[model samples]
Target: MFPKHVRTHHRLHHGHKPEELDFLIRRESVSGGATSSQMQREFGRLNEEEKENLLKGVGLRPGIPSGAGLLLKANLALSWNKLRHLRRWLRNWNVSLDSESKDREKAKGMTSPLVAEQLPFTFTVKGPDGKLATEVRLASCVCLEDISSTVLQRLDLLEREGKLTWHGVIPSDEIWLKIGGDKGGGSTKAVFELCNVAHPNSIENTIVWNIFQAPDRRHNIETAYKINLSQINALCGTMWK
Candidate 1:
């Protein structure tokens, strides 16, 4: 149970009903098992909104999120917020890259026309433990299948170099690109644009790429497809840590 001053603080700041606030304080007290001094220290760390939520509670009456759960949720929210910011940054980067590419193309004129439609992008492959396995530059203007193949080839090389190791065979079909930030679907044109934006120096230079290995299940592979660049950036922002 909370002290009189704590109750007054809740009433003053949160305006929660007395009975409701009492219930939440009791629940949190049981879940946290903190001394009064510890509680004060923890409470002091919370911002105004968090302090209000702590008193008012979350979810149902008895099912309020525990301190640990609240901490996890806060971390997740922070990560998502960072991801959103990264998405904005990537969008700006893409626009800048496009402008530069156009200027270079105009400068070259008809004398040095690009021979092949090469889409160079940076590839970042993560192992099963959510660690970076390898990162490389690849140039290809092809379908998703071809892109997956190229990524797999790089993974194979890394595995041989002892940079990456797998539990069992990571089938080529199980290897896929999580383009942009989406997990379900992506297209060649989107990949081309993303690569072009991320690799403005040369269409043959590397652009941002994310390689993920799906579960061994057939359904997972079937559902996997290319995703948008913003989505990829968002995913990277979240998963990189």
Candidate 2:
């Protein structure tokens, strides 16, 4: 089942099963023709603050209304087979615990001006022939040492040697990532706690791990894919309020 409000709205709007709702939510589909305004009306009793947090958790902004749509959309997006798994892995990725040895302000003066944001996450792309083209991973912990010469040197070594091992990922059956920190294998954490939610076990593990990085961007093609129209309509069902 989805969150309480989401489940209520699903029944009121579509008379659908949980799996069907799950499918529709990921696709961002609307059913039974509920408009965004309708959703707002349905959730009208919620306190303004609670509503706002709920919306943000699901990726909705303030004054956008569409409470129903927002809730469904967030659930769907977060549970998305590939994107959610990737996001969870990145969030759980542990940043190095070691404090910065040097000051960032001073280092800024010495180092070359930001060449580009250090790659946010790494992914592994495999071609039809099954040869690995690139290995990309996201980190859970973000700290000063991440960009240090030591880590860079390691990355360089991996690039030259072909196949780098990145670490600090949350451990979930769906969320598989290298465990530990640069100094040593760090502690292992679970994916459910990091995301604060869980999905049915029957769901297939159909997630891909890699894609090409567009210059100066934080997300890849897999992350940018859109949900279907039905979901958008359902989510929009409460937009007007």
Candidate 3:
């Protein structure tokens, strides 16, 4: 016999299974009908009586106030085959993680910026020529991961003769970077810890080493910078309390 939970949710038999049929029927109801080929197949397997029950809205309330419909959809969303989205999630997604308000004027008048206003800071990467390979900066936040990608790109490591072998990142103690004067890559912190930078302003300007400068650690490319942090700036008026 199938596990108790599995038996409660699904059944393989073609005979009338009220629990299983109700699940698929209710999915289509809140979802405005089957949206995909797989869904259409599962829906077609339902008995005529089940279809009739859905048409009569047997287990649902009318339109927007349909509390039962909301609960059913929420349950289905957690299933292996996600049936429908929670109504509030759809609303937030359309906001673009920015803002809603179709009226531009209302958005403009609001104090909150659509996306976080990223503070700009710069990094100087030295090329193979030992000169400025590229200048990298984020429109806002700065962290170890961000710097790694930027450093690799700015140094043109992709086009370089050597591939970045994943020997493993060096211990944070061996590789050094500063957010500001004495504020970066603490003596005890590791690269994993450095990745969680609290603020962008922490790494405004730092000199990244050329491979030649650290020949022994060249193969371990990810952690070769000797960065220094002078001032650590957190978001104004937006910091979490």
Question: What is the overall TM-score of model 1 with all chains considered together?
Answer: 0.17
RMSD of each: 21.2, 25.6, 19.6
Candidate 1 lDDT over 96-201, as tens digits, reads 1123334235445412112233343444589799998644343443223343334445445545665432225444323223333223333222222212122223
Q: Which stretches of candidate 2 lie over 4 Å from their true place?
A: 1-32, 63-241
Each candidate: what lDDT? 0.39, 0.35, 0.34
C-alpha positional error of residue 206 in candidate 2 after TM-score superposition, expressed in Å? 62
What local lDDT does model 1 show for residue 225?
Answer: 30
Best by lDDT: 1
* For model 1, the run of ten residues with the poorest summed lDDT: 190-199
- For 1-241, candidate 2 gives per-residue lDDT tens digits of 3333344445544877788767656333343334455566656978977775676678643332323322332346443344334434433432111112222333355332222222334445896899976555653321222122322343344347654322334332332222121121331111101121222121121111122233222343222212112322343232211
List model 3 lDDT by residue over 1-241, tens digit each. Answer: 3233333334432465788676655554544543366566666888987764664564442243323333343334343123233434544332111122222344244222222223323445798889985443433322332334343342343226343222355443232223322223322122211221222222222322221122122222233333211112111122211
> How far off is residue 150 in model 2, in Å?
57
- How displaced is residue 51 in candidate 2, in Å? 0.9
TM-score of each: 0.17, 0.16, 0.17
- Output the better candidate (1/2) by TM-score: 1
TM-score of 2: 0.16
